[model samples]
Target: MRHLKGGPEPDKHMLRRELLAVRNGLTTDDVREAATGLAQHALQLPELAHARTVAAYVSVGSEPGTLALLDALRERGVRVLLPALLPDNDLDWGAYAGEGSLARIQHGGRMALFEPVGERLGPDAVTDADVVLLPGLAVDARGMRLGRGGGSYDRVLARLERAGARPTLVVLLYDAEVVERVPEEAHDRPVHAVVTPSGVRRFS
Candidate 1:
Protein backbone atom coordinates (compact mmCIF):
# COMPACT_ATOMS: atom_id res chain seq x y z
CA MET A 1 0.00 0.00 0.00
CA ARG A 2 1.12 3.54 -0.69
CA HIS A 3 2.03 5.55 2.41
CA LEU A 4 2.46 9.24 3.08
CA LYS A 5 5.37 10.93 4.84
CA GLY A 6 6.27 13.50 7.55
CA GLY A 7 4.20 12.67 10.64
CA PRO A 8 6.07 10.93 13.44
CA GLU A 9 5.42 7.30 14.32
CA PRO A 10 3.16 7.04 17.35
CA ASP A 11 5.34 5.02 19.65
CA LYS A 12 4.80 5.42 23.39
CA HIS A 13 7.22 8.30 23.68
CA MET A 14 5.96 10.12 20.60
CA LEU A 15 2.36 9.60 21.68
CA ARG A 16 3.17 11.02 25.10
CA ARG A 17 4.83 14.04 23.61
CA GLU A 18 2.00 14.62 21.19
CA LEU A 19 -0.61 14.19 23.86
CA LEU A 20 1.17 16.65 26.11
CA ALA A 21 1.50 19.10 23.26
CA VAL A 22 -2.19 18.83 22.51
CA ARG A 23 -3.11 19.23 26.13
CA ASN A 24 -0.89 22.25 26.59
CA GLY A 25 -1.91 23.97 23.38
CA LEU A 26 -5.66 23.38 23.70
CA THR A 27 -7.95 24.29 26.54
CA THR A 28 -10.97 22.27 27.65
CA ASP A 29 -13.19 24.83 25.96
CA ASP A 30 -11.21 24.50 22.73
CA VAL A 31 -11.50 20.72 22.82
CA ARG A 32 -15.22 20.91 23.45
CA GLU A 33 -15.77 23.32 20.60
CA ALA A 34 -13.67 21.29 18.17
CA ALA A 35 -15.32 18.07 19.21
CA THR A 36 -18.77 19.56 18.83
CA GLY A 37 -17.94 20.83 15.38
CA LEU A 38 -16.42 17.56 14.31
CA ALA A 39 -19.40 15.63 15.57
CA GLN A 40 -21.67 17.90 13.58
CA HIS A 41 -19.61 17.32 10.47
CA ALA A 42 -19.71 13.56 10.98
CA LEU A 43 -23.46 13.61 11.49
CA GLN A 44 -23.88 15.55 8.29
CA LEU A 45 -21.96 13.00 6.24
CA PRO A 46 -24.30 11.30 3.76
CA GLU A 47 -22.76 7.95 4.54
CA LEU A 48 -23.57 8.34 8.25
CA ALA A 49 -27.15 9.50 7.60
CA HIS A 50 -27.88 6.64 5.18
CA ALA A 51 -26.20 3.97 7.25
CA ARG A 52 -28.71 1.58 8.78
CA THR A 53 -26.16 0.21 11.22
CA VAL A 54 -22.96 1.79 12.49
CA ALA A 55 -20.07 0.68 14.66
CA ALA A 56 -18.65 3.51 16.76
CA TYR A 57 -16.11 3.72 19.53
CA VAL A 58 -16.70 5.18 22.95
CA SER A 59 -14.22 7.98 23.16
CA VAL A 60 -11.47 7.78 25.75
CA GLY A 61 -8.83 10.37 26.56
CA SER A 62 -8.99 13.59 24.52
CA GLU A 63 -10.69 12.28 21.40
CA PRO A 64 -13.47 14.08 19.58
CA GLY A 65 -17.03 14.18 20.96
CA THR A 66 -19.52 11.38 20.19
CA LEU A 67 -22.25 11.41 22.85
CA ALA A 68 -24.50 13.95 21.14
CA LEU A 69 -24.00 12.40 17.73
CA LEU A 70 -24.80 8.96 19.10
CA ASP A 71 -27.98 10.23 20.71
CA ALA A 72 -28.94 11.95 17.49
CA LEU A 73 -28.37 8.77 15.51
CA ARG A 74 -30.52 6.78 17.89
CA GLU A 75 -33.25 9.39 17.58
CA ARG A 76 -33.09 8.93 13.81
CA GLY A 77 -33.70 5.21 14.32
CA VAL A 78 -30.27 3.88 13.44
CA ARG A 79 -28.76 0.74 14.90
CA VAL A 80 -25.51 1.49 16.74
CA LEU A 81 -22.92 -0.93 18.05
CA LEU A 82 -20.01 -0.25 20.36
CA PRO A 83 -16.92 -2.41 20.69
CA ALA A 84 -16.64 -4.68 23.70
CA LEU A 85 -13.02 -5.67 24.21
CA LEU A 86 -12.84 -9.34 25.10
CA PRO A 87 -10.56 -11.06 27.60
CA ASP A 88 -8.11 -11.95 24.87
CA ASN A 89 -8.06 -8.35 23.60
CA ASP A 90 -10.25 -9.08 20.58
CA LEU A 91 -13.39 -7.04 19.99
CA ASP A 92 -16.87 -8.40 20.65
CA TRP A 93 -19.66 -6.08 19.56
CA GLY A 94 -23.17 -5.47 20.96
CA ALA A 95 -25.91 -3.09 19.94
CA TYR A 96 -26.23 0.26 21.67
CA ALA A 97 -29.90 0.96 22.34
CA GLY A 98 -29.36 3.92 24.64
CA GLU A 99 -27.28 5.04 27.62
CA GLY A 100 -29.79 3.73 30.16
CA SER A 101 -29.81 0.22 28.70
CA LEU A 102 -26.05 -0.08 28.42
CA ALA A 103 -24.13 -2.30 30.83
CA ARG A 104 -20.47 -1.89 31.53
CA ILE A 105 -18.20 -4.75 30.44
CA GLN A 106 -14.53 -4.98 31.35
CA HIS A 107 -11.89 -5.73 28.78
CA GLY A 108 -8.36 -4.63 27.98
CA GLY A 109 -7.53 -1.85 30.43
CA ARG A 110 -10.82 0.01 29.99
CA MET A 111 -14.57 -0.52 30.29
CA ALA A 112 -16.78 -0.91 27.22
CA LEU A 113 -20.44 0.04 27.16
CA PHE A 114 -22.68 -2.58 25.59
CA GLU A 115 -26.30 -3.62 25.09
CA PRO A 116 -27.71 -7.10 24.57
CA VAL A 117 -29.88 -6.14 21.63
CA GLY A 118 -27.80 -7.40 18.70
CA GLU A 119 -26.13 -10.66 17.82
CA ARG A 120 -22.89 -11.23 19.74
CA LEU A 121 -20.69 -11.81 16.74
CA GLY A 122 -16.92 -11.69 16.74
CA PRO A 123 -14.65 -9.33 14.81
CA ASP A 124 -16.25 -10.28 11.50
CA ALA A 125 -19.40 -8.57 12.74
CA VAL A 126 -17.91 -5.33 11.42
CA THR A 127 -18.66 -6.65 7.93
CA ASP A 128 -22.37 -6.12 8.47
CA ALA A 129 -21.96 -2.53 9.59
CA ASP A 130 -22.76 0.26 7.15
CA VAL A 131 -20.23 2.57 8.74
CA VAL A 132 -17.43 2.15 11.26
CA LEU A 133 -16.15 5.14 13.21
CA LEU A 134 -12.68 4.21 14.38
CA PRO A 135 -10.87 5.85 17.28
CA GLY A 136 -7.28 6.90 16.70
CA LEU A 137 -4.47 8.85 18.31
CA ALA A 138 -3.83 10.64 15.04
CA VAL A 139 -4.65 10.38 11.33
CA ASP A 140 -3.11 11.71 8.17
CA ALA A 141 -4.33 12.84 4.75
CA ARG A 142 -3.61 9.46 3.18
CA GLY A 143 -5.94 7.72 5.64
CA MET A 144 -3.13 6.25 7.72
CA ARG A 145 -4.24 6.06 11.36
CA LEU A 146 -2.09 5.95 14.46
CA GLY A 147 -3.88 3.78 16.96
CA ARG A 148 -2.91 3.52 20.62
CA GLY A 149 -0.25 0.90 19.85
CA GLY A 150 -2.72 -1.92 20.37
CA GLY A 151 -3.59 -3.55 17.06
CA SER A 152 -7.21 -4.25 17.96
CA TYR A 153 -9.00 -2.05 15.41
CA ASP A 154 -6.43 -2.90 12.78
CA ARG A 155 -7.00 -6.60 13.28
CA VAL A 156 -10.78 -6.18 13.23
CA LEU A 157 -10.73 -4.07 10.10
CA ALA A 158 -8.40 -6.56 8.42
CA ARG A 159 -10.75 -9.38 9.33
CA LEU A 160 -13.66 -7.43 7.83
CA GLU A 161 -11.72 -6.84 4.63
CA ARG A 162 -10.91 -10.52 4.37
CA ALA A 163 -14.64 -11.16 4.68
CA GLY A 164 -15.49 -8.52 2.06
CA ALA A 165 -17.02 -5.99 4.44
CA ARG A 166 -18.05 -2.83 2.60
CA PRO A 167 -18.47 -0.63 5.63
CA THR A 168 -17.27 2.93 5.19
CA LEU A 169 -14.47 3.33 7.73
CA VAL A 170 -14.26 6.87 9.07
CA VAL A 171 -11.80 8.34 11.54
CA LEU A 172 -12.75 11.28 13.75
CA LEU A 173 -10.18 13.81 14.96
CA TYR A 174 -9.62 17.44 15.86
CA ASP A 175 -8.56 19.68 12.99
CA ALA A 176 -5.04 20.05 14.38
CA GLU A 177 -4.54 16.31 14.53
CA VAL A 178 -5.14 15.90 10.81
CA VAL A 179 -1.66 16.08 9.33
CA GLU A 180 0.14 15.43 6.07
CA ARG A 181 1.05 11.87 7.06
CA VAL A 182 1.15 9.35 9.89
CA PRO A 183 3.51 6.48 10.51
CA GLU A 184 2.01 3.14 9.54
CA GLU A 185 2.80 -0.51 9.93
CA ALA A 186 2.31 -3.04 7.18
CA HIS A 187 -0.72 -4.40 9.02
CA ASP A 188 -2.37 -1.05 9.66
CA ARG A 189 -5.86 -0.57 8.22
CA PRO A 190 -6.63 2.39 5.99
CA VAL A 191 -9.74 4.43 6.71
CA HIS A 192 -12.12 5.58 3.92
CA ALA A 193 -12.55 9.12 5.13
CA VAL A 194 -11.80 11.50 8.00
CA VAL A 195 -14.00 14.06 9.77
CA THR A 196 -12.55 17.01 11.59
CA PRO A 197 -13.99 20.23 12.98
CA SER A 198 -13.35 21.78 9.60
CA GLY A 199 -15.22 19.21 7.49
CA VAL A 200 -15.23 15.69 6.11
CA ARG A 201 -12.51 14.76 3.66
CA ARG A 202 -12.26 11.59 1.60
CA PHE A 203 -8.93 9.77 1.65
CA SER A 204 -7.48 8.77 -1.68
Candidate 2:
Protein backbone atom coordinates (compact mmCIF):
# COMPACT_ATOMS: atom_id res chain seq x y z
CA MET A 1 0.00 0.00 0.00
CA ARG A 2 1.36 3.40 -0.99
CA HIS A 3 1.45 6.13 1.62
CA LEU A 4 1.46 9.89 1.06
CA LYS A 5 4.96 10.19 2.47
CA GLY A 6 6.40 7.73 -0.09
CA GLY A 7 4.60 8.37 -3.42
CA PRO A 8 4.00 11.40 -5.57
CA GLU A 9 0.48 12.74 -5.34
CA PRO A 10 -1.35 11.62 -8.46
CA ASP A 11 -3.01 14.20 -10.72
CA LYS A 12 -6.31 14.85 -8.91
CA HIS A 13 -8.05 16.49 -11.89
CA MET A 14 -7.57 13.41 -14.08
CA LEU A 15 -8.64 11.10 -11.27
CA ARG A 16 -11.83 13.12 -10.72
CA ARG A 17 -12.73 12.95 -14.43
CA GLU A 18 -12.00 9.24 -14.58
CA LEU A 19 -14.12 8.48 -11.49
CA LEU A 20 -16.97 10.67 -12.70
CA ALA A 21 -17.03 8.84 -16.01
CA VAL A 22 -17.33 5.51 -14.22
CA ARG A 23 -20.12 6.77 -12.00
CA ASN A 24 -21.96 8.34 -14.93
CA GLY A 25 -22.19 4.93 -16.59
CA LEU A 26 -24.23 3.52 -13.71
CA THR A 27 -27.95 3.13 -14.45
CA THR A 28 -30.81 3.98 -12.05
CA ASP A 29 -31.23 0.35 -10.99
CA ASP A 30 -27.52 0.03 -10.37
CA VAL A 31 -27.55 3.08 -8.15
CA ARG A 32 -30.65 1.85 -6.29
CA GLU A 33 -29.22 -1.58 -5.57
CA ALA A 34 -25.89 -0.12 -4.55
CA ALA A 35 -27.64 2.24 -2.17
CA THR A 36 -29.45 -0.62 -0.45
CA GLY A 37 -26.28 -2.67 -0.05
CA LEU A 38 -24.30 0.32 1.15
CA ALA A 39 -26.89 1.14 3.80
CA GLN A 40 -26.88 -2.41 5.11
CA HIS A 41 -23.09 -2.51 5.23
CA ALA A 42 -22.78 0.89 6.89
CA LEU A 43 -25.40 0.15 9.50
CA GLN A 44 -23.31 -2.79 10.65
CA LEU A 45 -20.42 -0.60 11.68
CA PRO A 46 -20.05 -0.44 15.45
CA GLU A 47 -19.26 3.25 15.31
CA LEU A 48 -22.40 4.08 13.33
CA ALA A 49 -24.66 1.58 15.07
CA HIS A 50 -23.83 3.13 18.42
CA ALA A 51 -23.74 6.74 17.37
CA ARG A 52 -26.18 9.20 18.92
CA THR A 53 -25.60 12.02 16.47
CA VAL A 54 -24.51 11.41 12.87
CA ALA A 55 -23.52 14.10 10.43
CA ALA A 56 -24.21 13.02 6.83
CA TYR A 57 -25.09 14.33 3.38
CA VAL A 58 -27.78 13.93 0.77
CA SER A 59 -26.46 12.20 -2.34
CA VAL A 60 -26.79 13.87 -5.71
CA GLY A 61 -26.30 12.68 -9.29
CA SER A 62 -24.54 9.32 -9.63
CA GLU A 63 -22.94 9.49 -6.19
CA PRO A 64 -23.45 6.49 -3.97
CA GLY A 65 -26.97 6.99 -2.64
CA THR A 66 -27.17 7.93 1.09
CA LEU A 67 -30.92 8.38 1.58
CA ALA A 68 -31.42 4.81 2.73
CA LEU A 69 -28.69 5.01 5.33
CA LEU A 70 -29.82 8.44 6.47
CA ASP A 71 -33.41 7.30 6.84
CA ALA A 72 -32.39 4.16 8.67
CA LEU A 73 -30.36 6.16 11.17
CA ARG A 74 -33.33 8.43 11.75
CA GLU A 75 -35.61 5.45 12.19
CA ARG A 76 -33.25 4.12 14.85
CA GLY A 77 -33.90 7.31 16.80
CA VAL A 78 -30.46 8.67 16.05
CA ARG A 79 -30.15 12.36 15.35
CA VAL A 80 -29.03 12.69 11.74
CA LEU A 81 -27.43 15.95 10.70
CA LEU A 82 -27.19 17.00 7.07
CA PRO A 83 -25.14 19.81 5.63
CA ALA A 84 -26.37 23.06 4.12
CA LEU A 85 -23.76 24.60 1.84
CA LEU A 86 -22.87 28.14 2.78
CA PRO A 87 -22.03 30.91 0.32
CA ASP A 88 -18.32 30.60 1.06
CA ASN A 89 -18.35 26.80 0.64
CA ASP A 90 -18.45 26.22 4.38
CA LEU A 91 -21.23 23.98 5.75
CA ASP A 92 -23.95 24.68 8.26
CA TRP A 93 -25.73 21.63 9.63
CA GLY A 94 -29.40 20.88 10.37
CA ALA A 95 -31.26 17.90 11.77
CA TYR A 96 -32.75 15.45 9.28
CA ALA A 97 -36.40 15.17 10.35
CA GLY A 98 -37.38 13.07 7.35
CA GLU A 99 -37.62 13.27 3.55
CA GLY A 100 -40.38 15.85 3.92
CA SER A 101 -38.13 18.14 5.97
CA LEU A 102 -35.87 18.85 3.01
CA ALA A 103 -36.28 21.58 0.40
CA ARG A 104 -34.54 21.87 -2.95
CA ILE A 105 -32.46 25.00 -3.29
CA GLN A 106 -30.34 26.01 -6.25
CA HIS A 107 -27.08 27.49 -5.07
CA GLY A 108 -25.96 29.82 -7.83
CA GLY A 109 -25.07 27.68 -10.87
CA ARG A 110 -24.53 24.49 -8.93
CA MET A 111 -27.13 21.73 -9.00
CA ALA A 112 -30.09 22.10 -6.70
CA LEU A 113 -29.45 20.46 -3.32
CA PHE A 114 -31.99 19.09 -0.86
CA GLU A 115 -31.35 20.77 2.49
CA PRO A 116 -33.22 20.77 5.79
CA VAL A 117 -35.93 23.38 6.02
CA GLY A 118 -35.60 23.70 9.80
CA GLU A 119 -33.57 26.20 11.76
CA ARG A 120 -29.91 26.33 10.88
CA LEU A 121 -27.92 24.48 13.54
CA GLY A 122 -24.77 26.50 12.82
CA PRO A 123 -21.42 25.14 11.67
CA ASP A 124 -20.27 23.98 15.09
CA ALA A 125 -23.15 21.52 15.16
CA VAL A 126 -20.95 18.92 13.49
CA THR A 127 -18.59 18.81 16.43
CA ASP A 128 -21.35 17.20 18.44
CA ALA A 129 -21.64 14.24 16.09
CA ASP A 130 -20.31 10.84 17.04
CA VAL A 131 -19.98 9.85 13.38
CA VAL A 132 -19.61 11.80 10.16
CA LEU A 133 -20.52 10.36 6.75
CA LEU A 134 -18.30 12.03 4.20
CA PRO A 135 -18.96 12.25 0.47
CA GLY A 136 -15.96 11.44 -1.69
CA LEU A 137 -14.93 10.33 -5.16
CA ALA A 138 -12.56 7.64 -3.86
CA VAL A 139 -10.43 6.31 -1.02
CA ASP A 140 -6.98 4.73 -1.18
CA ALA A 141 -5.52 1.79 0.73
CA ARG A 142 -4.46 4.10 3.54
CA GLY A 143 -8.02 5.54 3.80
CA MET A 144 -7.04 8.93 2.39
CA ARG A 145 -10.15 10.22 0.59
CA LEU A 146 -10.36 12.02 -2.73
CA GLY A 147 -13.11 14.57 -2.52
CA ARG A 148 -14.86 16.56 -5.30
CA GLY A 149 -12.37 19.46 -4.72
CA GLY A 150 -15.14 21.63 -3.34
CA GLY A 151 -13.17 22.20 -0.07
CA SER A 152 -16.35 21.94 1.98
CA TYR A 153 -15.37 18.83 3.94
CA ASP A 154 -11.86 20.13 4.33
CA ARG A 155 -13.19 23.02 6.37
CA VAL A 156 -15.39 20.63 8.31
CA LEU A 157 -12.42 18.44 9.16
CA ALA A 158 -10.31 21.44 10.07
CA ARG A 159 -13.05 22.67 12.36
CA LEU A 160 -13.32 19.29 14.01
CA GLU A 161 -9.59 19.28 14.53
CA ARG A 162 -9.64 22.77 16.02
CA ALA A 163 -12.43 21.82 18.39
CA GLY A 164 -10.65 18.66 19.52
CA ALA A 165 -13.45 16.48 18.18
CA ARG A 166 -12.57 12.89 17.31
CA PRO A 167 -15.70 11.63 15.61
CA THR A 168 -15.56 8.41 13.60
CA LEU A 169 -15.03 9.54 9.99
CA VAL A 170 -16.50 7.31 7.31
CA VAL A 171 -16.78 7.54 3.53
CA LEU A 172 -19.42 5.93 1.29
CA LEU A 173 -18.29 4.56 -2.06
CA TYR A 174 -18.76 1.77 -4.56
CA ASP A 175 -16.46 -1.26 -4.26
CA ALA A 176 -14.37 -0.24 -7.27
CA GLU A 177 -13.70 3.16 -5.83
CA VAL A 178 -11.58 1.69 -3.07
CA VAL A 179 -8.33 1.51 -4.98
CA GLU A 180 -4.71 0.77 -4.17
CA ARG A 181 -3.91 4.47 -4.11
CA VAL A 182 -5.23 7.98 -4.44
CA PRO A 183 -3.31 11.26 -4.44
CA GLU A 184 -2.80 12.52 -0.89
CA GLU A 185 -2.02 16.08 0.10
CA ALA A 186 -0.75 17.54 3.37
CA HIS A 187 -4.27 18.38 4.50
CA ASP A 188 -5.59 14.91 3.69
CA ARG A 189 -6.39 13.00 6.86
CA PRO A 190 -6.94 9.25 6.74
CA VAL A 191 -10.50 8.10 7.44
CA HIS A 192 -11.41 5.38 9.94
CA ALA A 193 -13.25 3.33 7.33
CA VAL A 194 -14.96 3.16 3.94
CA VAL A 195 -18.37 1.52 3.52
CA THR A 196 -19.31 0.18 0.08
CA PRO A 197 -21.94 -1.99 -1.54
CA SER A 198 -19.72 -5.06 -1.18
CA GLY A 199 -18.71 -4.51 2.46
CA VAL A 200 -16.50 -2.39 4.72
CA ARG A 201 -12.75 -1.87 5.14
CA ARG A 202 -11.02 -0.23 8.08
CA PHE A 203 -7.74 1.64 8.51
CA SER A 204 -5.54 2.85 11.35
Candidate maximizing lDDT: 2
Model 1 clash count equals 0
lDDT of 1 by residue, 1-204 (tens): 222234454454575467547745777677778778877889998998899999886664456777667778888898888777766667888777777656655455564444344567666667789999987766776788877666678778887879888899998877666666666667777789988788888887
Off by over 4 Å in 1: 1-16, 20-28, 104-119
Tell me how candidate 1 scores on lDDT. Answer: 0.74
Residue-by-residue lDDT tens digits, candidate 2, 1-204: 222222355688988888899899999999999999999999999998899999999998899999999999999999999999999999999999999999998999988898999999999999999999999998988889999999999999999999999999999998888876788878989999999998999998
Predicted structure 2, TM vs. truth:
0.95
